[model samples]
Target: MINIQLLNKDFESRVRLGIMSILMVRDWVEFKELKELLDITDGNLASHAGALEKNQYLQVRKEFVGKKPRTTYAVTQLGRKSFQDHLAALEKLLGQP
Candidate 1:
């Protein structure tokens, strides 16, 4: 019988994967920065980000930069640890451990 269990899934969805991938690399990133990295549309990024924020895995800050609005995101401590664990699991699953 083939197993149907999920294995080493870093994210529940692809958009979330992209977000986590970026966060895993940098200490902090701007909203636009993530958008550019994933090449995803604004709405798409927003939706994905919303989910992350809801989980408290990402922290968001909004501020004004000389009359311009700017938004930035940083991975929370929990996020960093979680992503690391996820990666480790993936490596093990792929026989890379």
Candidate 2:
């Protein structure tokens, strides 16, 4: 039987998956960039980001860019590992491994 327990429920959302995909390649991503890239509203992005933060999958940094506040996100090591495991599970599911 194939094991299908490795996928993380937290990352099941496409928005969250997209966030992880972007963060996996870069050290950090700005909130505005994510909002625009995902074509999601502030509240939508914030809600998903908040869920990730609550899961300790990502860290949020808030700072001032000039006078305006800028928020950035970075994936935690645990998050990276979790994402990798999830991908491996997907590959296994597809008989890639």
Question: Which prediction has the highest lDDT against the true structure?
Answer: 2
What is candidate 1's TM-score against the reference?
0.81
Report the C-alpha lDDT of model 1 over 1-97, residue by residue, as the tens digit: 3222434343767788789888877877888889998899999998878877887778989999999998888888887777677666666657642
Task: List the candidate 2 regions with Cα displacement exceeding 4 Å.
Answer: none
RMSD of 2: 1.5
lDDT of 2 by residue, 35-87 (tens): 99999999999999999999998999999989999999999998999999998
Give candidate 1's root-mean-square deviation (CA, Å): 3.2
Candidate 2: the clashing residue pairs are none
* Predicted model with the maximum TM-score: 2
CA lDDT of each candidate? 0.78, 0.92
